[model samples]
Target: MTQQDVVSTGSTTEGRAPKGKALAATERIQAPVGGPGRGPMGGGMVGQKAMTFGPSARRLVAQMRPDRGKAVAVVVLGVISVALMSVGPRILGQATDLVFSGLFSRTIPAGVTQEQAVEGLRRQGDGNLADMLASMDHVVPGQGVDFDAVRNVLLVVLAIYAGAALLGWLQGFVLNTVVQNTVYRMREEVEAKINRLPLGYFDRSPRGELLSRVTNDIDNVSQTLQQTMSQLMTSLMTVVAVLAMMIWISPLLALIALVSVPISLLVTRAIMKRSQGMFVAQWRRTGRLNAHIEETFSGHSLVKVFGRQHEVEETFAEENDELYRVSFGAQFVSGLIMPSMMFVGNLNYVVIAVVGGLRVASGSLSLGEVQAFIQYTRQFTQPLTTVASMMNLLQSGVASAERVFELLDAEEEPVDAPATSAPAVRRGEVAFEDVAFRYDEDQPLIDDLSLVARPGQTVAIVGPTGAGKTTLVNLVMRFYDVDAGRITLDGVDITAMPRSALRGQIGMVLQDTWLFEGTIRDNIAYGRPDATEEQVLEAARATFVDRFVHSLPDGYDTVIDEEGSNLSAGERQLVTIARAFLTDPALLILDEATSSVDTRTELLLQHAMAALRTDRTSFVIAHRLSTIRDADLILVMEHGAIVEQGTHDQLLHAEGTYARLYNAQFAQAVA
Candidate 1:
């Protein structure tokens, strides 16, 4: 979970969305996949498991294919490093033999030759001692250890080890570079993928869970590669190099060590099989816990208002406990590997020692060779153990990679239309020709809807909640495409025009205002980024934003806090209106734009909007019937169809859906 707390940045909707559409972000309504208590952003349902292990593991490896050159460099360095280190034990063994030979020379008593003394001892019935002495090379009868020779061999061993250490460090550096660079590109791809995804994808997926995939999962992948790859390469190489040395020293000892390989593999494979699912569950639970926490903090006020804090706490405890349980299980299962491998290694050690001793007693192998062989035995078994222990990291990384891959592979919005298809000139005349749409195939929202908003006209839309008020404006913006019919601007089909070009000519102010963490001037200029100071002030005044802004200490220069918590609801709405006004769009869309402000401010905004709507086509979705009293034409929608269309007075005279809605509101106001 993230340490930084962030307020939820979403707006309010007066009505719920149609089926197949995501519920307003603020609602706890359950979708098919993510139910209530799943938290906002819709975390994965309980008992959901990760993807198959093999394919995910393969895909992760494919990600590293681009870094093959650096990987090869690491491998080459590891091989050279291991080779050099492998030679050190043998050289040290030479030093040991020299010391043993010098100590034995004094006990031999000056003789014709060392061979003659060994033969005399053998004839005197001391066969075992004679045999041991026979294994020593170049031992003069009365000479002590040659300190100078021993020092030379010891220096060679030190030099070999130092060279090996240098190469090992170099290998690690290159491997780290490869892992970091690969992860960097992976992060870039994921970020780009997020932009390409459709709005609905976000509706279904939890924000916290998606964030976990993008941030925590990718970071884990990086750490896993960094921790395991270099060591894995070096350990495997050490095993190969040390095994070769062992075989050369004594085939019998080498064979004995090989006995542990199959046993170790069986143990590793068995434990990995059992632990993989636990790791998957561990990460899944982590995402759920994060989502719960995000929802709890983002909607903290509502929780307190309804006295749901205790319930929220209980939910959090449940998810947190689940995460803990799975995490502990994964760790406990994978942790058994090192000790088990160590036990097997110890048994092999005992067998090799006994066999090597017997060979030395019979003079089949010299004592120094036996000592070097014992060291090689440790070198071989140690790398095997190291490789076995890396399984835990490997499984965890692949699990994260699967989650990230799922995001990268999500369906994206269709590509934009060609620029050549764009209209030569954009006029504010919008027509819906026999349009039909459904959020879900079985449940239609709008059907055979046809209407036209002529240039310089204000078309007021009033309806009950879920009357497709926002959906109508959303269609104009092409936030979604129609299922059967085409919408046109200036007689040019909107689908033919590039979406960007079509949307650029339109300005929208939603009921739920959005303001970023920047100065008021910046937020107002968001719709037209290159707007001049004069243009900004002009737009602000026209939207009544300047009236309150100038009263503040910094005026337009005042910076909004995160999610604009520092601004009042009306102030934030006015800022958004000014942003839309600055664009000077050919068309305008307002969804209860004046809902957040008081009556006085609403009257001022009405006048401002009236002026701005001159010579511009505007679509106004209103819940307050009183607000549309002076509108040139009023469209009363019911069940996604326009049930009444005319001036406001005509609609009331008709005594249909519009009159009932208006009278109800009037009566409620009086009450």
Candidate 2:
């Protein structure tokens, strides 16, 4: 089968996408396939089991360690803000108590003088008896209320609230800046990490999955930071402050409120445990569904041509249904948290109100204290619910963070050795010495391979499908290092030079032509960004690319489609050849470079190739015998090894593999 067929059939496995539409880098880091938790569609959430808030989470936090000062400021501000807000209930309760005391003192049996009320309060050991009676001087006994005292207490409450508001806003502002900046830094790190990752990493990972890590996972982390950072601090502080105030008011009432804590904890833990798996499943299924949609849409033409639209739709429906089922389960389970907490909270409320009413009647507590304790009870339960919800949000965010960290922590391509040196100039001499290589350790591909090409030589490599023609070119270009042995340029090991320096001297044109969305000139000059217009035009003319450019309305300035869909296959190939020509490298590797063009265009390209090959080492990988008939050296490869090496005519006379291949093509042409 052709490589395209292999890719299409094997796409169910990870790392493969539809033809002509490889997933971008952002999509490759999504959840893994069939991992720990099973989504409705049987897919696994990406990074669900990779790491939690353990060491990996600590490392994620360490990313923000640089902003530790701002973080500390936010914490300090939050604590003060919550503390000030918590005092509002108590202060308001004190106002209620004052009003009640003044009204009680006024009702003093209607015949008692103000002196008797004051003396009675003093006898009862009231700490503020003098102040209370002085404030009541304008009030008639049993007829007037102390409005001045109420007003003063209310003013104090107002000041406390205003202070809390100001601090809360300041805290929010600083925390937002901290979270956004941290996310920004993480994105930059991810981008840098992508560059350092070896090509083999991409080969084994799906582009969609990686894209998820860069975009989706990172965004999740950012969102969680934005949402939970302030809430976590506030909730925790509120809970502590409310509990302390409740205890200060009356320890018996505080104990009554505390009964709900264990119940709430048990309910929250149960629900969280069940919903955690569903959450993982939901995200995994979401990734799978997205991948399916991407693949189907990208290959819509193939589906219609092969009349598989029904099958494709059925597959989509299956995945969609699974996603819906798991999503519903996740939402349903998590949804139960609020109502359950409310039930526990209400139960606590009932107990506090009943016991507090008895205490008030028995004179151990006042009405205002009971009211304040009820408010504290409500405040306490609220934080519990807020914390539960935040935990869920944090868990998902942590999962996504783990995935992003995984990508960042991936093994990078080996750096150039300290002693490595770049050559002053390239001489175009190439040699492969006793090379043994494999994509997998157990399945050897290239074995004991050796060859040499002197300066200015054209070496043709011809092989059948799956015979390692492309692999050989990849090794020469240093896309993959040899497992054993060494490739040398000018008698110096290529590995001794930096990868960029090694690849800088070589240019490659592959069978699959890629063109970005830009003007035709831009694509042609991509390999040599600094090329002059004259140089670009010269290369274009040599590759016969000018033939089509002149016909277009925009000439060389025409904007190509993202995939160069506006240009014919042969036209795109010619443009890539021109791009390679403009690079003007000492070594050129062309793999099936002319396979797309017609015979006439091939003839034109041959003229260009012949001129371009002067004083340069060229490796031409092709199946067409006619193009390479005059090559100085012809290497016949079969099953990853060079089975025959000779001139084309010499091989034809020997009647070996190359002879049979050339004869068959010749006979077919004559027919």
Number of the top-ranking candidate, with lDDT as the measure = 1
lDDT of 1 by residue, 1-671 (tens): 00011111132223543334543232222344434233332234323446777988778767878889988898889989999999999889899889988998888777558789889989999998789888888698987789999999999999999999999999999989988988999999998888766555555456677788888999999988889888888888899999999998888889999999999999988998999999988888887777777777877888888888888888888899989999999989998988999999999999999999898888888878999999998999999898878888888988888778877766566787776555566669999999998777888889999999888889999888877877887677766678878898988888877666777888777776778788999888877778899999999988888888878879899999757887777778777777878888899888888887899778887877776677799998888888888888899888889888999889889998888999998987798
Q: Report, for every candidate in turn, its global Cα lDDT versus the true structure.
A: 0.80, 0.76
Runs in model 1 deviating more than 4 A are 1-49
**Alpha-carbon deviation at 473 in model 1, angstroms:** 3.0
| Model 1, residue 502: C-alpha shift (Å) | 3.2
Model 1: worst 10 consecutive residues (lDDT sum) = 1-10
Per-residue lDDT tens digits for candidate 2, residues 115-190, read 7777787778773643445434343567556788789989999999999999999999999999999999999999
lDDT of 1: 0.80
* Candidate 2 wrongly placed segments (more than 4 Å): 1-49, 53-57, 109-143
